[model samples]
Target: MGEHSKALEYYEKSIKIKEISLPLAHPDLATFCSCIGGVYSKMGEYSKALEYYEKSLKIREKSRPSTPPDLATLYNNVGQLYGKMEEYSKALPFLEEALGIFGKSLPSTHINIKIVMNAIDRVKEKL
Candidate 1:
């Protein structure tokens, strides 16, 4: 679990396999990219994390419906990554977008909506 490099290796291998078997725009490919982004984020490689996250976000944007929850999750991931990188100004808009989508799609009191709202508040405080 603490083996970040090992985790990354496996993630990359899985992505390669999925890429060969799945369509370019497949949601599974997006998810694979997002998983890699998360691993990079946990390793504190913020730039790499952002790159993979942007890849996932772009794929999801093209493949998923406009208001899919996965899109909100990717936005939240990018926002949190920016926040962790101390780029709060950049984080706020992404977090706010996640908050808006969660608000529209989830119950008012849903935990995800609450989490996104709290993240937005934290980013705003940093601004």
Candidate 2:
């Protein structure tokens, strides 16, 4: 519905404001990009979603999040989006990065570990 479009517009506005107010490399810009990406993903705009997600990743790489898992989560988001778009090959590395990070950062039995594992498995199945 229009609600999602409206939300996307609002997020875009917020991103513009943040860009003007914060440093060019600010992590909050990445957050806004991720939010917009998620909204685009939900709206089935895969290309636009990937665009914003990549922007977020670029910013995150520059900033280096407080936790490794934070970067992993972004990887996982991009990976999952690629998977959703049926680009299994593209999904593999990001999912692997996410898995590797989660493997190092969390306990073996952590749910995130399981989630990424399952996602990897699913992507592999598609491949």
Candidate 3:
């Protein structure tokens, strides 16, 4: 818990600095947000995790021409977070979207696509 708090503190500082120096929709900013979101998720702060993940997704959606792999990752993260929150209905669409994007952008045998597939299956079982 102490280690996670320390990491979160550093991540927040880094995000603040990047926000000042980088464009609003910068890919690096999105990545930083996602990293912070992951930390929050590990710390069991699901709302904070979802907030940062949504911020990351907003940036990616505005800056990228098409659905990038990172956007897919954000979807997967948000979906999993909702699952952790036991919001199975909320989790389904995001997981399905992530699975669809991963299917199109990644190779058939890629681990990411498989992971999304497994998540979708798990969510379905919960539903």
Candidate 4:
């Protein structure tokens, strides 16, 4: 089940299926890459995680409409990874980018956007 240990495997399977069936640079594939990247991050393979995340970002940039939610989510993921690695300076840019995206996509009163903004502020303060 998805809630169990097979979650990552399922995500990978889905990604592979999408990659074969979908067009190049499809948003679904990009989302799959992001999911895989998150899994890699959880597994403590930061480099691999980053590689997937970057790949996802590229696909989103090329294929998706420039929606704030999408860019912000990707940036937040990259920023969080860098934050985990103690690369605060590198993290700041990504977090800032995410914040900018949120600013455009969601209203200021939106809970998730505000939460992301708070996180960016906290990280910036630490940096």
Candidate 5:
């Protein structure tokens, strides 16, 4: 918790500085937003985390190629957050989207596929 708060404070400060110099839709801003979202998620602030995650996702989708790992990672993060919030119905779609992207982007034997598969399964069980 202590580490998350510290990280959150730093990320917020850096993001503020970045916002002035960078365009509103810059990919770097997305990265910082995602980082802040991770910190919030760690601190159990799910809604706040989702807000940042969605912000990051919007920018990333617009700026980057759709097949990249980071986009898939963002999907996974949102999915996991939904799962944590016990929104299993909402969680399934995001997790499945992550799994699809991971499948297309990562090697067949990659560990990420297995991890996401397990997350999807867990969400399904809860549903």
Candidate 6:
């Protein structure tokens, strides 16, 4: 935790290794791409984050259905990143998707559903 840079460096290396060893369209590789995007987003690198997040989403969509928590998590993550970037318009769709997934998969009163609902509301206010 204290050495975030070092941690990210290792993650990047591992991601590259996965890319070389796995199929180009592998979901695991997509997950790694999403992790990279999240790291970049946390570092306040919006463009890089958006690029990788989109790549992850595309790969996941192609390989699996969109209802998995993995897909919802990515949607929420990218939406939150967009929210942080003040791109509220773009954030809504992702947040909405996350909300839908949780609503369908989890109980109505689940914490995750509430969290996504709040996120959607926040984005709506901004837009």
Off by over 4 Å in 5: none
Q: Local error of candidate 3 at 23, Å?
A: 1.1
Select the stronger candidate by lDDT from 2 and 4. Answer: 2
Clashing pairs for predicted structure model 4, backbone only: none
Tell me which of candidates 2 and 5 scores higher on TM-score: 5
Q: Candidate 3 deviates by what RMSD?
A: 0.9
Candidate 1 shows a clash count of 0
TM-score of model 3 (CA atoms): 0.96
Tens digits of lDDT, candidate 3, 38-63: 99999999999999999999998888
Q: After superposition, how far is residue 18 of candidate 2 from its true place, in Å?
A: 0.5
The CA lDDT of each predicted structure is 0.92, 0.92, 0.92, 0.84, 0.92, 0.87
- The TM-score values for the models, in the order shown, are 0.95, 0.94, 0.96, 0.86, 0.95, 0.91
> What value does the lDDT take at residue 95 in candidate 1?
91
Cα RMSD to the true fold for all candidates: 1.2, 1.4, 0.9, 2.4, 1.0, 1.7
lDDT of 6: 0.87
* Cα lDDT tens digits for candidate 6, 1-127: 4465665787789888988898888899888889888888877788988999999999999888648878888999899989999999999999999988877888998887888889999999987
| Candidate 1 all-Cα RMSD | 1.2
In candidate 4, where is summed lDDT lowest over 10 consecutive residues?
A: 1-10
Candidate with the larger TM-score of 2 and 6: 2
Ranking by TM-score: 3, 5, 1, 2, 6, 4
